[model samples]
Target: MAIQKRVGIWIRVSTDMQVKDDSPEHHEQRARYYAQSHDWQVMEVYRLDAVSGKSVMQHPEAQRMLADIRSGHITGLVFSKLARLARSTKELLEFAEIFRQEGADLVSLSENIDTSSPAGRLFFTIISAMAEWEREEIAARVAASVPIRAKLGKSLGGQAPFGYQWSGKEFVVNTTEAPVRALMYQLFLQLQRKKSTAQELNRRGYRTRNGTQFTATTVSRLLRDSTAKGERRANYTQTTGNNKQWVLKPQSEWVIIPCESIISPELWEQCNGILDNQEAKRRPRGPKPVYLLSGFVKCSCGTTMYVYQSSKNYACKRCKTRISVADIDEIYQVYLKEYLSGINREDYLRQSDQQLQEKKQLLEVTVKERTKLAKRITELVDLRLDGSLTKERYTEQYTPLEERMQQLDVIIPELEAEIDVRNIQLISSDVVLTDAKTLYDEWGSMSLDQKRAIVEVITSKVEITKQDITITLAYATPPSSKSREKVSPRHGFMLAISITFAG
Candidate 1:
């Protein structure tokens, strides 16, 4: 008796909900039954979820299926339908050619396409074009609804502005953040410099909506948004590269959205009115100050501390509070000795190694998530190319996926860098302690930049007042001391020591 032919079954679905009944799972089961009835061996079952009609090579298992086919491990390939394999006529024909070249038979159970026969090639072209037309018509209907909703003043459907939250129907004032938004506008009008306004907010312990310290550039973008005046604008553009990104286009082309205003017309006018003058004389920003705790230091009065290069100290430009540079180094010596003492010294390597292991595991998870998103993007592109989905449907899904991909692309690298840094810091804890002590011993010989690098890595913040100094270490379990230690060891150290900085 002749040996039975081996075949692989491929199945795909755009969502998990679709797999429940008579779907990819059921279809796979049906395809297997068909293969068995025909006296064929089921070599493999290839499956993918949330995948669109992209190339087989774009998916993980799909690539394996093709490899098995090309290697002659399987002489036949089967699927429930042609739509699962491809959406466009061109792609359907291409898949047929690949199976032919690999000397494998292609069968689609629903459409009765048996590419080993001549008649199957004719139906493949005619039916795919018809399916493509149907998909385009469905997309056209969805795209037609957008302008109608916009004319009716319905929400355009995206994240709401900074000072407002979407209420399902429309945006309403976010009471907590509206006050901050108003104050930002007020401060900008008074200070005339967005950078100064950001500093003022930071001094008062104000942070952006996301809780990170705000920058001068952040302040400018928020104020210029014009949504505070109840006008939401769109069609903003960005430059392709470098520091000059998010550049706005002509004001005439902007589409202003009508919504509830957070600030008065006069306040809005006064703030933006200064833009022309500011731009005319504004010099390109100078290099950022070189200080160990550049963004981390806070003044006793609560504003950020700026570096005074001449005296080699940190001072608040607004309040004139200053801390001598040498004092911070002096305090570091105290921290290191306390931290590296008897019991803590013994536990250093164990503690660091544990933390590094945890961070590395999280990094691996993030990288995997990023890969899945990349595959989804490939599926979307293929769907759009074959007219399987309309431009509007593609955009609705593609835009957010791309945005998330960008965020992950940024975050993944940062996580990897953190893992690298933590490994170095923890694995070499003894060396860090010894090297730090030695650096202080030869402090006079080290350059300012060298000191900044060491200080930046070890310390998180330095808060200086007229009477005392408080330092926070970047360590997991800080060297314990009885100088008003926080109740929870989880909260990083809030160590305070009395030191006088002469005026």
Candidate 2:
């Protein structure tokens, strides 16, 4: 007598099948009888109870059966019917190819079909065509319902926008979102009055519907949106092909019912007028002479310091304290030397280098951990094939581990790049310090034009007081003088020196 070939039994019943009382025991009994009649050994029964055949690969026991087939543990597979194996035609054909390449056969007991027989191949092809047609038909029905449902003012499959909540059939105003909408209107008005651009408005903290920080383009879109004006404007174009056009139904064609107004129409118009004026003012003028402290200087009296061109001096509007630009520039240089003296270059470089090395080491460890976890997942898959682990046991153990491994994979690259950045900063600190020193040494020797460039780099602003001079320096960009004087940390990059007359 020829020895019996080892056979693996796969059984699946979708949720609807369970409602109809389809049982795995019935499949197991039939599979057992078929195996016995064929003189085949029943190695193991992999039953995916209450599982859908639509995505057969996701069925726990079905996945185990596939792994076993690939590992050469099972010589043949037996199921109840073609649909029991997979409802998806693509998945069914893929499984058929895998079994064929592995020299394994698939047997459906009720259909009296086996991949080893020519009739079985013809039956499978016919079944696959039917299943694919059914899927396409179901998809078409759902796609056809979308526009009809949307016209009915029903929820059409996406989350409702801010300031609205989904009612049973229509969107209703949400009280909680009302305040946020009001705040957005207020911000838009403020931006307009300040004569600010969209970028400036965003920097002052405007956000989007999703709570994400707003960009210039997003702000512009919101301003032009007719929805905010209590009107629906459409006829918008969505071109799929070059020179192809389709008439788009406007939002006004759907439904226009008033809920609540966040801002008055008068206020909204005023804001729009302000935005238009600001945009006009932002247009480029001819090249203007650069003022050393144009943007940086602030009046001690809490206002912007404006340079008076006729007087050739800087004056605080509120305080009316006038000082020659040249005198302030000289005073700024003296203060820069005092601030540079406080930093110990050798010590700062040593600490920065140590931090860079530590970051690099951490990055290496993270990479190794990610690699180890990935290798372990492959080993777990192999273990399932060798029958050392059941499908349920492998999934329960590997799923969380796989998720953690994916997170580590994303994080490791970010850490490595950060380490590289820190390393560069440490290596270049000395070069930056030397440049600062060179600029300071040449300041007195340079003409007014050259002096202006050096001043622009070293000092941002110079505020003169009755008793002392306060200088604000650029961050990370150091000044030339090397004096070991203690500077207060509060006024970041600031140096305060009492004015003294020559004795």
Candidate 3:
């Protein structure tokens, strides 16, 4: 009677091996042939291609082979060579122990090493050392390459930031994303005016490059970044120590290139000043009354307005304009009514129709532009195929155009959706008008801050001149109070009488 030997064959080839003639198929064939000669039944062939042998356990085929061995599906293992099994000494030892525990044998065909023989055991140890050396050399090579690539202004490794993309070797500025970056700068400025921290900014819908909600640390980092100030930075590293941690390195030590400035340096300085002031104010101090409009109110002198309360009235410190809080509240309500009255819904409908027409025209223009770009790409592809363009030149030119086409594809859909929404809003003007009326009816019951938000949405600016106050409504023409020949009532209040008494 002849004993049948069930054997699992393992084959591996690293990324570098794929470039050579010696492929995974060649190794598999060799292992199968050797197994047959030894009268071993080939149970399964586990081929792992383009995967490093250093981490053999992570390879899908290797894992399956291990499972088969453990389940007694195979009593022997065969490979082209020991290195084909794993490139790490620790991994080789672990596999050997597994085979030993399972009462199975491992055979390397080319090395003539078998776990069943004494001489083969010595050879396995030598092969394991070689594998460990190979892994260490590869690691050292990678460690050396990263800094050189970074110095060349290439991305080493990490997720790309907004307004920039990684094109295999270099970081290229995406023009479409530039506007979003500019918006962040604008938002930061608005936050500075409100004397709010990054936590507050995040809570108000600000997000990071990855569209994740922002944290206080992320905000602080953004504020301190010279990149927002139109400077490029490099070579920054995060460090960890005994519990306490903070961002290190002086500003001078950072590699900075002045790209197109997103935010002016002066504005950056002003934001820093505001942040410092807010931090100082947060410290232990006497309890102060919290005013919702504290940061938003501005004096006529262009200085930040403060709310000063006296026994008699609230006074504007710079303008010396003293008015009772109740009188101020009444005047605010009257101003709101006047602003709401000035919004002629019919005129807005006419303008919306005009805008809809303009959008249609714009869409036609965009379609034409897209057609031109597609034709250009077709021409470039033909030129490259016909030998008119070298591979390098074709790639350099084609990549940017391809990226632009992708961006256009994304933008065109967004524009079309926006136009659709605008058209719907314009057509349903009556519905919007009804909603606005309802909001106005309940305006008096709203909190002061809520009232201010409502008023700001409808009115852009309200200026009180010596004779009459001028109100500029958003998306509408400004109205002069002097033009009113009579003390006309607006929003259920006489605006002329309210302004006169407000003084």
Candidate 4:
């Protein structure tokens, strides 16, 4: 009787591969049948489930079978088809080389190719090219479907953003988290500061929808995002560069759908206005300012004012204008104090409450908007998997959506604060005075950064021309909310001041 050759049967089945009516077990059975017909004994059956045939690096079973072949334990490795072994033509060729070097054989039952035969080796090369071609074709078809799925407003597939949950086929509003959405926009509008909002959120004991604390950066991003305006904007970013991070894509390619607005366009603009100019001037870290308003001061001629010679004077480069830093500082404080004197705490607090209540209502509707955007991402993934979306398209949309959800993860929790009419304690006028002499005494003891922080909170622009020095502040507050927590010993009123000093 002829000695039956010792062989191994290799089988792999991914979800898409199983759609071919070829389960791993069925492939193994077919391989065994083919081995039986060739008078070969199957020593081992190597199986990989839910594994892609892209590469052998991750397949432990396939690697082990290869080792066995190299050790002369098995004479052949048999699978149903060449592509089932590996989708890449280069990888298949490498496998062929490995089998050839090991003095073993690779046999595909369906393709009827045995690597031991000369004609079979030639057929392997041809089949490999065809397998690669099919993969590219499938990829092309998937890529072509991205705009189609996007136009149809389908769910792309990903974890739901805050205030929304996946409902299998699509995203649905998460009833429990709906209120947090409105509060976020309201907080930004009322506070006009991300750091203050973050502090309030942390103090209110509200966690993100994912149960994380809020940060200034996260709050800033959410406030800037137009999605809060009741529309879905998709495909605005794609993963690029070697490290694979999301960056902006063209606006023309964005998939926008109007669902429901969380914050009115007017309120969004108001909040974003403060958030936008917050980073207009970049300050160098660890550098102490020689002049209190160096970068903060701008020349009317559209150039930056710099401190010249003895720190007391600031000169403009383009306009050749100069102003005394001492004069600018004195007048700025006088105007600031004058502005604070008119503020009635109760009036502003009432306005803040009204803004808060209105925003809370708006945030509730944001749940619907979030669900639509979040669901659209999931739909893209489903479309890609089912051959409606290309991998490139799915990746571009899915990655950026995930990053946005991450931003939401940090923002949603911050919507909760301790600022309701009954609970919040506002600074009384007597307890926190905004007098210039009282501030100067505290300023003498503060660090440069602390001084700068106070200036940033108060001063918006210090413009110097030939005749006068005019510093226009956006708004200033005396010991209020989180701002007061950082700027100790001074806090009171919300005031905008314009102070002018003779140059």
Cα RMSD of predicted structure 3: 33.3
Candidate 1 lDDT by residue in tens digits, 203-316 = 999888789987898888888878899886655443433133557667654556687889998898888888667887878988765754566677877787866667777788
Better of 1 and 2 by lDDT: 1
What TM-score number comes out for model 4?
0.31
Give the per-residue lDDT digits (tens) of candidate 4, residues 1-503.
22578999887776665746654654665566566655688999888777777776457887798888988889988886778888877678678766755768787755556654333444555645665576578856865676677677676546555656667755456667656766877887788778888878778887677788988877776676676676666656665432458787788878886655666888888887776676675565874456667688887787888887665667876777766676666555555556455456566656655666665565455445556768988888789989987889889888988887655433332232211111121221221233323564576688766776556545567766655456664432332321111111122322233353210
After the best TM-score superposition of candidate 2, give how far the Cα of residue 362 lies from its true spot, in angstroms: 1.0
- Residue pairs of candidate 3 with colliding backbone atoms: none
Which whole-number lDDT from 0 to 100 does residue 389 have in model 1?
91
TM-score, model 2 to reference: 0.36
RMSD of every candidate to native, in Å, equals 27.3, 27.2, 33.3, 35.7
Best candidate (score: lDDT): 1
Least accurate 10 contiguous residues by lDDT in model 4: 481-490
Which model is ahead, 2 or 4, in terms of lDDT?
A: 4
Q: What lDDT does the true structure give each of the candidates? A: 0.68, 0.62, 0.61, 0.63
Clashes of each: 2, 2, 0, 23
Best-matching candidate per TM-score: 2
Model 1 alpha-carbon drift over 4 Å, by segment: 1-147, 234-257, 282-503
The residue-by-residue lDDT of candidate 3 on 316-354, one tens digit each, is 566764333454445556655664576677666678778
lDDT of 3: 0.61
